[model samples]
Every structure is written in structure tokens, then in C-alpha cells.
Target: FRQIVVEFLRPPTHSDEQIRSMKAKANFPTDIGRRLRFENAFCRAWDLNLPPQQQHDVRQHILSYMLVFTTASRMRGIHPDGAPGLFDHTYEDNQVVWKPAPEDAAGMPAQAYGMQNGSADRAMGCLLV
Candidate 1:
């Protein structure tokens, strides 16, 4: 996947026009369409007997993941998988800081999307409790 992306972003072998057309297609809301399609399919796949709070919790958890994934994926420079590191610290004076984790010592950039309110971490915590 990395190889493919690196190749795609490289020069003249792929012209400006081709790159523009590819990006134009790739920029479309395909993920939204696919997610909506799957959401409907999943809704039909199971008849949940869950209570209201349980249902709300389930939806919140799903939304939390979606929010984090979307924000992280759209972040400048870093890949989606690296977004999880953004949750590894506590808010300090309203600033997002990175606590050194062995897996990701550099941590996510403070300016990364959704770093405010610790949304991703908060959502993950809500999932556990």
C-alpha cells in the first residue's frame, strides 16, 4: 500500500493531467457512499434487542471511531494508522501534547485534526466503560 502511494505521488511517468484526473476521482465521497451502503446492510443483517442506552452507546462507539478515523486520515503528512498516537496524552493548558509511547515516540502533531477536546481518546474511554 505504501509502495503504491509512493509510486502514485511520483513524477513524469505519471503526468500532471493523469494525476489530476486520478485525484479528482479519488477525492469523491466514495467512503461516504460505501459506509452508508454497509450501514444499511448491517441494519438489515441483525435485529438488535439492545436497550436504548445500549443502542446509544453502540452508536457512539461507532461514531467515535468514524470521527477519529476520518480526522486522522485527513491529517497532513501522517498516515491514518499513526492517528491513534494523538490520544496518548492529557490536555495541558488546553494544548494537546504527546506523551512518549514506545510505539510512537514522535507522537501526532498538535495541529492534527480533532486534537481538540481529546475526542478520539474520550470516545475510546467511553467504549471501555
Candidate 2:
């Protein structure tokens, strides 16, 4: 995405009312109206708990995050555990046991979770998330 477009995708750090107004001004539906939000991407990036380099190939996290969230919001019924697989279906014993469950993804706000003080050697946060 262009830098301007990327910046536009950034969610406001204000109240929902403020966000709504901003969205309206920008012709968005307050809650993004299906556009990708930086925060939502950040959450999916957080989900893997993998190093930043690895996260790059994970569906270009930024684009897929909001797409996944939009899908989730519109979906009904039981969603699977794993959603964003590269393939359409997860085959097991010639049976489609699981498919992408991107719908169940959590669209987080654009907040980088900080650890006040912790050993880099220690695995934490999304490791347990």
C-alpha cells in the first residue's frame, strides 16, 4: 500500500465517538466499513508470537487482518481454530477436517503491548495468548 494509504489505514487513538466522526469525515463507516485497520493487523501479527521476519510471509499480516475480521463479523455458526491457511482446505485422511478460520480472528487496536520489564530470554505474552 502507498504510505498515504497505510497512514489512512491507521486507526485513531481516540474514543469511538471520535473515531466515528473521523470515519464519517473520511467517508468510512465509523468501524472501518471493511477497510483494513492497523490495529487489527497488529493483533494478527501478535498472534503468531513469531519473530518479525517470519511474520512477513504470514499473509502480509497487514492486508489479511482486516479482511479476516470483516469475514468474522459477517459470518455465522461455529468457526474453526485455524483460519488463514495458504490453501483452501486442510485435508486429513482424505477428509476436509479443517479449513481456514480467519473469521474467528481478533481484530485488536493499534497498540503495541509493552512489557514493563522482562528478560528477553523469557517467552511470554502471545506465547500464552
Top candidate when judged by lDDT against the true structure: 2
Tens digit of per-residue lDDT, candidate 1, span 1-129: 111001124323334564345434331211211123122211211111112112111010111011112122111122233333333333222122222222221232222222222332222111010
Q: Give the Å shift of residue 36 in candidate 1.
A: 33
Backbone clashes in model 1, listed as residue pairs: none
> Candidate 2: lDDT of 35?
26
62-99 per-residue lDDT for model 2 (tens digits): 12222211111111111122233322211122121112
lDDT of each: 0.22, 0.23
Error of 2 at 68 (Å): 2.2
Q: Which portions of model 1 miss their true places by more than 4 Å? A: 1-11, 28-129
Return the TM-score for candidate 1, rounded to 2 decimals: 0.16
TM-score of each: 0.16, 0.17
Best-matching candidate per TM-score: 2
